[model samples]
Target: MEKSWNNRAWFMVLPVLVLVAFSAVVPLMTVVNYSVQDTFGNNEFFWAGTEWFEELLASDRFWEAMGRNLVFSLVILAIEVPLGIFIALNMPRKGIGVSVCLVLMALPLLVPWNVVGTIWQVFGRVDIGLLGHTLEAIGIDYNYVSDPIDAWITVVLMDVWHWTSLVVLLCYAGLVSIPDAYYQAARIDGASRWAVFRYIQLPKMNRVLLIAVLLRFMDSFMIYTEPFVVTGGGPGNSTTFLSIDLVKMAVGQFDLGPAAAMSLVYFLIILLLSWVFYTVMTNRGVER
Candidate 1:
């Protein structure tokens, strides 16, 4: 039986569509306009026709920054996903302890990104910072400012501390939503803890896990402020990920053409990788 379609629903969505066009589409158009053109001065633009794109693709500096971004994202996902799941598993499932644990997990996430960076920056200072001072007292060399490895470790650990709570919260929500009948059935069947987690909880949490992965991946890939503030893309470009390099090119060096080209490419890489991840994970979920 055919029913009348509610064409008026379009009216309800028009404001949101206009807002999206204003916020997203307009900036995207500006980027596209700049990507293929060269501006010298007086707002005069000359057509460069992929010149910037070619140079960016050929540049070793661009690729190195991209490699660093990829490595950071991979390391973050490796640590955060499992650690978040484990933490969620151990969290109190009910009562006042649940609220307390949840609040503590929420605290890190509530801190502003730049503030997190600043806190870590001070915390890792070699002179008076607790972490740095403690390490020095223990006879370990720890200086994020001087050592590339130390910078990497500090950034990675900072990210994990700040964002792992997000994954934990999401996984915990998934955990709590599971019906008690499933656990009762598992218990009746004498299912081991590992067996219950593997067969029931993990499968139930797959959707949320996928959500956590995509969010973490996109955030980590586009990370700029935290590392920028902490290391400022140094210890000599050791932690200069793609976003940092883009800012250096655009604002620091004032090279709009190459920066615009790099940004578009950056956007495309993120889109492609995220799509791949979603496809692989969703396919696995469907099969299971």
Candidate 2:
């Protein structure tokens, strides 16, 4: 006799499916529609084919923003990954200190993206911000508003501060999952700290490390709100990554067809790169 199956569970997910259709699928279809068509108001639209995509691809501004996005993501991963690993390695494996460290780390992740931007915006101000004023008081000329380097620095630092904790938490989770038997064997074998990390910790944490890298890469590549609120993609568009540039085209400039095309390209780039990252890492895991 066959037992019963809970096909009713499908009903539980129907609401979520409907909500996703309305929120994500509908908007995506609208964007796709806009991408292949042109309009000049009054609900009039004309077939534009791949014209907008060709124009966007030819634009130097788009390429420049893409370059910036790539650079930023690379820099963020370079800094955050090692730093998070270091922090996790050093964190107490047991005690009340563990809880304290976790809470402190989690606090940054809890702040809203917009709020993080605002905090940094004020913090980096030359006149009213502590950092700016401190730098000036120390006789260093610091101004995020006027200097491209300063703007980039402020944005990078803000992102590092906010997101490094997430990496730390992930790495910490990976670290804790490591069995004590491995450490005992290493200790019995007289393995150095470096050896332990290179052999035991790094290998064990590889999966979570991949996850951390992927998350940080995507977040950094797609970063907009913090930089937008802080710099408005300014100091002469020096900090304008793809998202900011896309917004300028779609909303500021109101070029829907081109913007829609750009958006699709952006989505594809992200999806492709993320797939590559996942494949490479998981394959390495399999090999090891």
lDDT of each: 0.94, 0.94
For model 1, state the Cα shift of residue 48 in Å. 1.0
For each candidate in turn, the TM-score is 0.91, 0.92
**Scored by Cα lDDT, where does model 2 land?**
0.94
| lDDT of candidate 1 over 1-288, digit per residue (tens) | 999899897899999999999999998888888899999868999999989999999999999998999899999999999999999999998899999999999999999999999999999888988898899999999999989999999999999999999999999999999999999999999999999999999987888999999999999999999999999999999999999999999999888888999989999998999899889987987898
Q: Cα lDDT for residue 265, model 2?
A: 97
lDDT of candidate 1 at residue 201, scale 0 to 100: 95
TM-score winner: 2
Clashing pairs in 1: none
lDDT of 2 by residue, 42-138 (tens): 9999999999999999999999999999999998889999999999999999989999999999999999999999999999888889998899999
Deviation from native of the Cα of residue 57 in model 1, angstroms = 0.8
How much RMSD separates candidate 2 from the native structure? 2.5
